[model samples]
Target: MKNALGSVDSVLLLGGRSEIGLAVVERLVRDGARRVVLAARGDAAAIGVRLKDLGAEVLVLDFDAERPETHERVVAAAAEFAGDLDVVVAAFGVLGDQAAYEADPVSAARSMAVNLGGHVSAGLFAARRLREQGHGTLVVLSSVAGVRVRRVNFVYGAAKAGLDGFAQGLGDALHGSGARVMVVRPGFVIGRMTAGMRPAPMATTPEAVADAVAGGLRAGAETVWVPGRLRAVFTVMRALPRAVWRRVPR
Candidate 1:
């Protein structure tokens, strides 16, 4: 049996415990991915064991997204598990309280470091690996908030915007390396991360985003908008003048 992409044999998900990341991993496994490395903050025993039961050679690794210095070691560990990584998903992030962030610039900056800086370090390492191998996919979880900063979560949105731009530049840099990057911009995802939050229009689930990601991979798309309409929604949102944009309620 071939994987959804028809050739992916191994996968490395950075935020292994992430609901969206795991959903994508599950889909890839069904598609023929035989080996997987789920690297997260703590023991991924539950997820690893589950995948093991599914017939994949699962490896659990320690990954701290906030510690950029350790990113190379994490990538190295992935190489030790799978010689040629078919897919690498960067899906670690935090949705801090907007009010708290507004109160403490320090906290907001730390959030940005984790969300954007971590990706920068890990992505570079993964890109180098993929470029050397000459074939692989890097999946980046961006957000619609990044399309246009809103007053509700501008700090988080700004970090995502930085990450989004970095992914694009990295993609261009790897144009001829046979390494591709897929950016997923999903609208409000009512997952563990967004628990207790009001669902946005066209809000989707992890499964929905996973399905969209699978489709994007198959189509070789550089960017994917979950619910598929966010692309258009943001187009108009971005065009709205500052006065109207500022009044959006949190």
Candidate 2:
């Protein structure tokens, strides 16, 4: 639950090893979040150690986003561990090669299952828990690529587009339930995810995104754009003619 000043007391991060997700958790811990639950596929020892160092009661659980059937149990376990979840961050995703997706549609589908389908299940489960508790925030990590799907990475962009819409609808559904949702739209983030790739215009870092998320949470913002300027950039990009937009490079 959140304190009188709107500081969260417990947090559950779905993507335990995500750079941006960990950054956000760190900021929340600094702001007085005492209990933390990190759910990911593999080991989360380092993250647990860091959170423990910050004075948080940390719990790392094995979670497979692709296995939607297990999401309810995952949420239940997290809730049981930390009591009422103050903040649930859904940040699991994969940025697969577009060329490979074009060649092997099955791989693209698998990526979409994790990036979009998994989120749908996790978001709904978390929302139900938050609604039951009657107060909390569900942070959905969307991407600007979803705003205007480019030819360069249409598969990943399409998945994000679906996620963005779902998050918006979920937020609306939970409007009066006292459990709100915050959708984060960040333009090309330069982090472990895109390590060897070329930087895109208006590229930001995990720390920058985390800072923006922390600020948004404090302000009770529904949607936040990292670096701030990307909102304007995307507005123009969305209105561009298809012919001109298709010519833009990745």
Candidate 3:
């Protein structure tokens, strides 16, 4: 639940080690979030130290995005740790190599399961808890690639498209429940996820994404675009003819 002054009292971050996710959690803690639950497959000690330095009570739980069966259990653990989840950040994904995915269809399928299937289960479970509490926020980190999936990375983009649509429909389902969902669509983020990848047009950073997310939460926005201009760029890009669009570039 939020404090009287509107500061988030507790938060649950699904991807504890994600650069963008960690940045958002740090921003939230700086704003006023006191209790935090970080779920990740690996050790989150480094992340824990940072949040603890920011004066937050942190708890870490083992979480594997590839396993949907454990999502409900993780959410319940978070709720048990911190009375009511005031905010939940669903940020976990893999920026897989398109060529590799093409060569190994099985790998691509697994990636899809983690990127899309995992979110579906986690988001729904969180929504259930939020609805029961009648107050909370779920921040879904989507990508502009979903708006217009390019051949260079269609596998990853396709998964994001599914996630974006799911987040929107889920938000609509929770209307008037006081448990709103905020969807963030950022362009190529130049961070750990894309360390050596070529920088795309209007590429943003994890920190920038975090800042936009914080602002969106404060404004109660359903959708937010990092740099605030990609919305217009994608609008035009989406209107291009198939032939011209395909020939534009990777």
Candidate 4:
């Protein structure tokens, strides 16, 4: 449950090893979250230790975003381990090579399955639990790329666009159910995920995004844009003519 100060008590991070997800969990723990469940495919031992050091009861579970069949069971197990998840972060995604996706359409479909389809399953499952318990926040890590798909990474952008819409609709559906969703749209984040990539204008870091998410959670914001100014940037970008937009470099 969330305390009077709007601080959560427990958190479930679907992308346990994600730099942004771990950063958010770390911030929440520092802000008084006592229990955390990290669900991901690979080992979470290091993050578990880090969270433990921050005074959280940490539990690491195996979760595969591509495996929709196991999502319900994973959510159930998380609930069983940590009663009433106050925050559930859906941060798993893949930014595959655009050239590869262009060559292999099947690969693009697989990536979409993880980014958009997996969230559809996990988001609904988490929403049901939050509704049953009557209070919680589901944090959906969307991207500015979704706001206006760029030609360079349209495959990834398309998936994010779909996810952004789904998250917004889900939030609306959960209104007045004592639960809500926070959609975080961040500009290019210079983190483990975007390693070796050229920095985009107004690029941010995982820590910055996490900070924004934590502040948004406290303020009960339905949507948050990291760096804050990206909201206005995207508004203009979204309005640009296709002729001008298509020429914008990656």
* Model 4 spans with C-alpha error above 4 angstroms: none
lDDT of 2 by residue, 1-250 (tens): 3454267899999989888999999989988899999998977677789889999999999889999999999999999999999899999999999999989999999999999999999999999999999889999999999999999999999999999999999999999888999999999899999999999988999989989999998899999999899998888999999999999987
TM-score of each predicted structure versus truth? 0.95, 0.97, 0.97, 0.97
Scored against the true structure, residue 213 in model 4 reaches a CA lDDT of 94
Give the clash count for model 4: 0
- Badly placed stretches (over 4 Å) of model 2 are none
Overlapping backbone residue pairs in candidate 1 total 1
Residues 6-26, candidate 3, lDDT per residue (tens digit)?
468898999888899999999
Give the range of the ten consecutive residues with the poorest summed lDDT in model 3.
Answer: 1-10
* Alpha-carbon deviation at 69 in model 4, angstroms: 1.2
Task: Please state the error at residue 42 of candidate 1 in Å.
Answer: 2.2
Q: Which segments of candidate 1 are over 4 A away from where they belong?
A: 1-6
Pick by lDDT: 3 or 4, better one: 4
